[model samples]
Target: MKTAAAAGEAEFYLEPMIVTAARYDNSAGKPGYYKVDEKKLENGNYDNALDVIKQLPGVTLMARGASGGMNAYSKILLNGSDRYLVIIDGVRSNWNGSSYNDFDFSVLPAGMLESVEVLSSAAGSVYGNAAKGGVIRITTKKAVEGVKTSINLETGSYGREQENILHLGKSGEWSWSVYARKSIMGDYSSARQSIPSYENVENAGIKLTKAWGETADLTLSYSVFSGRYKSKIFNYKNTEPDETKPPKLFKNIFMTDARKTEDNLTLEYERKFSDTENNIVGIYRRSSNAAYDRSLNVERPWLLDLRTEGFFDRYSKQWHPKHTLTGGVEYYKDQVLDYQDLAAKYSDGTVISKAVHLQDSWQLADSVKAVGSLRQDWNSYAGSKLSPALSLEY
Candidate 1:
């Protein structure tokens, strides 16, 4: 008889493990954090991050069209609307500099991720406005102790094909890793066979880490992604239906040919003062350029540039034999440059945001704990706002 581990490996070709922090835990007391590792990602036939996120609890994947096209938009919803924030390797992945504040998961490839953490509660006090709903954090694979390289290829119906390559190694005080992937799909008929749609995506990323002595570590990472999609538009009102056949839809005034490119760079430095004390500083820059071509043959372009820098300091100490105290402070600055109107060039503007937050956790008793957080934010458009949160668990 096959053991549980053997069965899981044979089915998914990866190990199976899940770690969760519930709201009613005794130690740490932090709640609603769930981790999904690489093995869980391979359990399903997932191509993109959205596909894997759909399987998570308390999440709903909503989409409209059968064909994945530029016109179709999908979102991951928690208890409410899709207002969640996405962070990759501690950097905000959502393109807040653009008109659309929501993060698009379709373009995020699943092959590059080593793990995903979902915090299914309001974290506004700690993460600012973007975390009003929740937060989804992604971590990429790190360099292995030994040199290793792997390649993967997959093909499916609708002429879909994908290829990926990854390499990682560690030597002395330096570690490095790189990954790349490309996917393409042939044109396919839409729901009513009224339109044909297709999409192509390519992405690559690299990370380099260096240890400065035993107390300090530094990491630099960069990633680039580009995608293009074409789809036809239909008129819902102008439809013809027959008794034995599906409805015939009228072609709209415009079809869509859209393209987008994103670039992200991040640098992080960390120092450990003690076993329970640490400090971190990070800086990141992201830019996105998008173009849309309508059936009229007119092209419209958009550009979004964003830069963020932040620092955090945390310490944990035991006040008594049975009581523990943890405290931390964080500060960050976000700047966004957006080009709104192209023809007139009059809608160009910049938004600056600065925030600082402090949090403390206290263990009151053997089964009781209290967590408190306070934050202050200053925005160019919205002025200032204060957020506070307090939670008690027993």
Candidate 2:
């Protein structure tokens, strides 16, 4: 870097970067955006994360996999306020009266993640209206100075299962880190047309962070998951099991169970004048859920959703010589209540919610980007949307 800018030292660039706008940084990639590298899993394991996002380039997937199945029902937005602006590390993964309730990459153990920031389209000035079909940002793993660890295992076939992760870290100035993960996905499957299959999945997570002095940082994270997808799934034989046609058989029976839990807490502050750095952050998130239709467990209908969310973000930065600027502004509030019960319903499924938020992302040139988002919503489909987004790079 021109001999470290002539010894004043300031040459930063590294890590498998790949971030299409959304105000870059995204760690690992010092400056030149587009960061990818931590474990290479766009969908190597498959079964979700949109199977590596349908395969990028225009991004589209149909009848491929990951529950977007019955045609398509996956929603991700930013810049507007689709599930409080769908986020990952900053928390909030979509849900506030259903955006199809994204985030079920089977349980996102994707090599414990470290990078993956995809803002597919309609950047809503930066990330709004669920980004239309964008925003899949995830950046995990940080807390370095010393000590690092990793472990993963995989098996195959219908009764297939396996997964394990453990991470430890220590950097300095009293820094600390800890993360844990576990998974078991069995009932790999044993029928396609004759029927009889089961799928069981589980996922877990834990994160802790600490740092004092010079600025300040504290973090706590917890995640939990449960899964149940009974099988007997297959499509074919539009007709023909017949001797007389009246026996033209067709059967569709399968049950499913799901549960999800998430918790997050963050507090950060940074004050530096000379190096030109600014940051103030506070975040709190919580989500609890349950679902079941059992395909028709005697009558179909059982779902409960409870959510609590709060997000406050602020970041500022400036670097000279040539020019480097970072900007941030965010505020989010979420409240939701969902209830459903039916064996033969008449009028009893309802959802009540409330929300308030704002978003901003700017980086004018390093690669070019801009984003703006504002949101206000209340209860069962009230109304409000103003999303803006733009990005340019060559």
Candidate 3:
């Protein structure tokens, strides 16, 4: 009863590459973790992290300002909100002073990143409040065994240009890497003939590592980013124009010109005490200063300068053949060095945050695993909270 076409259809099968699932053995104990590696970065032709994130599913991109213009402020939304946390090499980078705990991705240069990891599911139980939606972790390249250097130059339409340089080297027990990048984009006007918008960004970073015996290692890293942009804001009338007539006149309101600079320094130490036990400690400090100048709204120009310092210690132990236990504690302090307007200055009291977390992973069966986590966080501004989670995987 089988015809020729029917017989061929019975033998059809999917390709091996199409059916095989990619494995992630280095996910740092995160579930549903997806990573974009250097090879994928090369293929994506991405100029920044925001560009790369746009290709990922379940991530919504929100923009403010001109449509498709370089001066736009882009934000990422996961789990239907922008509550996700951004971490750079295990250090929280978001500004806690802001009502919404969000980090600006546009200021970071993609050229300095070695990989990007996204945890699609809720990670609040593990990472704390800012991770109620998800978590994005960015890792930078480390020095290799030998010297490696590269320089890249790119140019395109609309007077867009970018330059990047990277250097990595290792000598004796010391390894170091340095990266620098700059990008500039010319003005572009909207359909309303609003004033054109432009953007310029520069970033530099350095990492140093030292091997201390066979069981321990130390790493130090620092990065600085600066950006300036101009954009026009439009105001529209509520009343609708005549149906047969042309669109109503939209008044050009304020023209905003803004500048921001941020810097981060981190030091980390890792030690493998035994085959089944390891410990890590890290300290980091980040500072950001920004100025917003709006024409026509000259009554008040805004300035903000804030600094945050934090440290974390974590320990992992494989107590049983089928069970692993991990615990960590983190402490951070935030200070508003300057918050000023054209008329008066305001002082924001210091904010402190502390957290302790514990997690256990147990293999229940050959294909079944269980995970449980508990975390307590105390923030000067947000109060204290205890979060717990349990999950099973097969």
Best by TM-score: 3
Runs of candidate 1 with Cα error greater than 4 angstroms are 1-30, 38-48, 64-73, 97-99, 104-111, 190-194, 232-253, 297-346, 362-370, 392-394
TM-score on alpha carbons, each prediction? 0.74, 0.30, 0.78
lDDT digits (tens) for residues 286-379 of candidate 2: 6555555445343444555555555555454555433433434444544436655542333234444344444445555454555445454444
Candidate 3 local lDDT, 1-394, one digit each (tens): 9899877774558666746678655533434556788878878777678777766655787763222212334666765767777777767777652543556665455666689878644445555567656788788776668998888899987778888888889888999988888878877557867456677878888889999767988999898988877755444442445767666765647667878788999999989999899998999999877777655655566677788898999889999878998889999998988787655787775889999999888867655667888989998888999888787865
Q: Rank the models by lDDT, top first.
A: 3, 1, 2
After superposition, the stretches of candidate 3 with alpha carbons farther than 4 Å from their true spots are 1-31, 42-44, 64-73, 97-100, 106-112, 120-122, 189-195, 233-252, 318-323, 340-345, 362-369, 392-394
- Cα lDDT tens digits for candidate 1, 267-332: 888787766566666777776665554445333443344445555444455546444444445555
How does residue 46 of candidate 3 score in lDDT?
79
RMSD of 2: 21.2
Candidate 3: pairs in clash: none
TM-score-better candidate, 2 vs 3: 3
What TM-score quantifies how close candidate 1 is to the native fold? 0.74
The alpha-carbon lDDT assigned to residue 88 of candidate 3 equals 77
lDDT against the true structure, per candidate, is: 0.64, 0.48, 0.74
